[model samples]
Target chain A: TQLLEQSPQFLSIQEGENLTVYCNSSSVFSSLQWYRQEPGEGPVLLVTVVTGGEVKKLKRLTFQFGDARKDSSLHITAAQPGDTGLYLCATVPFNKFYFGSGTKLNVKP
Target chain B: DAGITQSPRHKVTETGTPVTLRCHQTENHRYMYWYRQDPGHGLRLIHYSYGVKDTDKGEVSDGYSVSRSKTEDFLLTLESATSSQTSVYFCAISETGGSYEQYFGPGTRLTVT
Candidate 1:
């Protein structure tokens, strides 16, 4: 079974602060996906990194897939209160999906 | 923000009771998925359906059952609610072309007391 472990289970920072979350795994994945979810809502996809060492940016958020395809990261620049939520990482395995433990981030204004 | 909608946004049920969660989608996507979220577990897939009448077990499939009678509807049922089953459930749909992007529903918060 493939499992993804996320670092800094909880993070609280003030507005305009920069933060980064890491997702690590022991097994290689064909692809990895990042998602952000608010309270009482399902997660929304942020980005999908397929190739090793691929980097994708979304506005103030940056995502990178490890060159080994076994880890990934999400970095936020100048995070605002609106960025507060639970960020999740998922790996697809032969039609089955596995998710990381998740990082709960709270950006206080 | 996907075209997915789950019924019974909030539910409170006693132990040993049977409860079914409904997921309806308007996108007509071929792949429908059910997931449960807890504090540290993130989102664990409970079950999924690739097409009408086709379903598969996910990471957390115990105490849960799913059915898809049509392409746009996927239902999750808990035969006997347990305290461990108290969590938020989400439904998602992925488009064709083997894309990794999936749209999800708002989610249903189910409490077992």
Candidate 2:
């Protein structure tokens, strides 16, 4: 079983549209991080949320940690073609890192 | 970009052959990790090192072994390559463990035939 579950598994949208991806788990985490992986590249860190109910904005992206610390969400406003990539959510619980299956986003021009 | 590089960015090996992938870093970080990324599985930890010569098994460590004789280098070896082991492997580094942001290497794609 996957420690973290992400949905929808795949998504495609026209440029300027808005979308949100979710990461959910049954266990609480000390911190949650969001990463974006482009084709032929490693995942890159986008944001890290450590506090429950904390929300952080990165340009057009917004990340929020759930109050219970078992969930997190990433929202993209006015998505662009450059935002096309695989979105993964990860956490380091008990000093071990776990990653979600990831949501593949395709923002068409 | 972090000063991390994985050798032979891509490799193809036959079954039953031993293969070793090397991860070199210049960040001087204390923590190094090896992870394999497969379809529908994101990235799963294979092994990790907290300091030179101090390592631990990750969630999926079977058939794999790691050596960290130096702080700047970590190596992952597959005793006998299997087709199921074909996947893109990534190396990551963190200044400290637990909640610290990790910097990832470009990754090495391995194909076992």
By lDDT, the best candidate is: 2
Question: In candidate 1, which residue pairs clash?
Answer: none
Q: Candidate 1, which segments miss by more than 4 Å at Cα?
A: B97-99
| Per-residue lDDT of candidate 2, residues A1-109 (tens digit) | 9999999999999999999999999998888999999999989999999999999999999999999999999999999999999999999876778999999999999
Model 2 CA deviation exceeding 4 Å by range: none
DockQ-based CAPRI category assigned to the predicted complex of candidate 2: high
Q: What is the DockQ score of candidate 1, to 2 decimals?
A: 0.67
lDDT of 2 by residue, B1-113 (tens): 89999998999999999999999999999999999999999999999999999999899999999999999999999999999999999999999999888999999999999
Q: Write the per-residue lDDT of candidate 1 for residues B1-113, one digit (tens) a residue.
A: 56788998999999999999999999989999999988767888899999999998988899999999999999999999999999989888997524378888988999999
Q: Rate the local accuracy (lDDT) of all candidates.
A: 0.90, 0.96
Q: What's the CA RMSD for each of the models? A: 1.5, 0.6
lDDT of 1 at B73: 92
How do the residues A4-97 of candidate 1 rate in per-residue lDDT, one tens digit apiece?
9998899999999999999999888889999898876778888899999999999999999999999999999999999999999988887777
Model 1: docking quality category: medium
Model 1 chain A is weakest, by summed lDDT over 10 consecutive residues, at A37-46
